[model samples]
Target: MSSYEENYLARRPEYLCHMCGKCCRVVTTSIPYKELKKRSQKGEKGASDFLSLFEPYESIEVARKVDAAVVDNIINRLIDDGNYNEEEITFYCCKYLGDDNLCSRYHTRLTLCRHCPSSPWSIVPPGCGFEGWLFWQREQEKQKVRLLKEELIELELLKHRTSDSQMLDKIDSVQSKIRKNINLYKRYGSENW
Candidate 1:
C-alpha cells in the first residue's frame, strides 16, 4: 500500500450508522420534477426524480437547523471550489422523505443515498456510513494528487534538458491545470467530482 493508503487505514475507525433519516429530511437538493424526469429518461435516475416528492425550505437557515455543521461544510466547500453560486447554495430537501422519516422511495433511491455519510475521518450523523466511505474517498483523492504531483515533477525535470522555453512553458501550464483539477476534487466530496 502507498503511504497515503497506509495512513488512512491506520486512522480508520469502527462505527455503526443508526439510520435515523434525520440527514435525509433535514437537508435535500431541490431538483424540479420536470428536470428530474428528463434526467430519468436520460438514465440519470437519481437527479431526475428526487425533486418530485419533497419540498425545499424557503430559506437555507431552516435546513441548517437540522445539522448546521454538515450544511455549513457542504456550502463552504462548494463556495471555495466555485462549483456553487450563492443562489445554488440555498437549502434544499428531498421530496420523498415521509413524515415517518423513511424515504418513500427507499428501494429506488439514488446512488448517493446508498452511500450517504460515507466518510471515514469525519464524524457522521447517527447511523451514517461516514467512517468507511470517507476514509476510502480520502485515500483515493490522496493517491490521485500524488500521481499528478509526480507527473508535474517529471515534466519539470524534462524542462532542464530542453532549451525550448515555449515547450517548458506549455508543460508548466498543463501542470497548473492538473493541480487545479486535483484541488477541485479535494474541495468537494469525492462523489461530486
Candidate 2:
C-alpha cells in the first residue's frame, strides 16, 4: 500500500463506530458468491478471510430483511456510482454476530472485520457514525488527485517550453508519476473532478 493509504488507516477513528451492527448484519461484496467461494478455496487471502466469518444470505431480499437501511444504502450508493449489477451482487452476514449486535468472536475477529470501513470510499450504512469521517476522507483524496492533475498540466507547459532532451525526459517521468496518482482514483470519477 501507499504511504497515503497507510496514513489514512492509521488515522481512522475506531471510536467513531456506533456499534449499531448494521454493517455486520448486512454486507455485500463486489463479486458474486460463487466467485468468492472459488477464490477462498484457491487461498486468496481477502476472499478466504471474508468467507471465514461471513456467509451469503439466501437472497438480497433476505439480506434486506436483516437490515433494510444498510442494504438499501449500499444499493443506492452502488446505483449512484454506476456500479450496480443485480446479477453480481451478493449480500452476506457475519456468522458470529450476536443478538445484542456484538461480535460473538470479538477477540478473534478477522482483520477484515477489524478493518471495517477499510477505505474512504467504503459505503457504510446510512446514519453510521463514520459517515462524516469517510466523506471527509474521500474529499481529501479527491483534492489530492486534483492537485496532481494540476501538476501534470504544469509539467505539460514546461515540456512545451523546453527543448533539452534531459529536461524533457525528466518532465515525462514526473508526468507519468502524477498521472499514475490520478489514475488511482479513476474508479471514483477523478476525471470529472
Best by TM-score: 2
Question: Clash number for every model?
Answer: 14, 0
Model 1 global lDDT (CA atoms, 0 to 1): 0.63
Please provide, for model 2 over 58-157, each residue's C-alpha lDDT reduced to its tens digit, 9 standing for 90 to 100. 8889988878888888899989988899988999888899999999899988878877788899888888899999999889988888888889888999
C-alpha lDDT of residue 169 in model 2: 96
lDDT of 1 by residue, 153-183 (tens): 8988998889897998898899889878777
Q: Which residue runs of candidate 1 sit more than 4 Å off their true CA positions?
A: 1-16, 28-47, 65-69, 76-88, 98-100, 115-128, 158-193
lDDT of 2 at 9: 72
C-alpha RMSD for every candidate: 7.5, 1.7
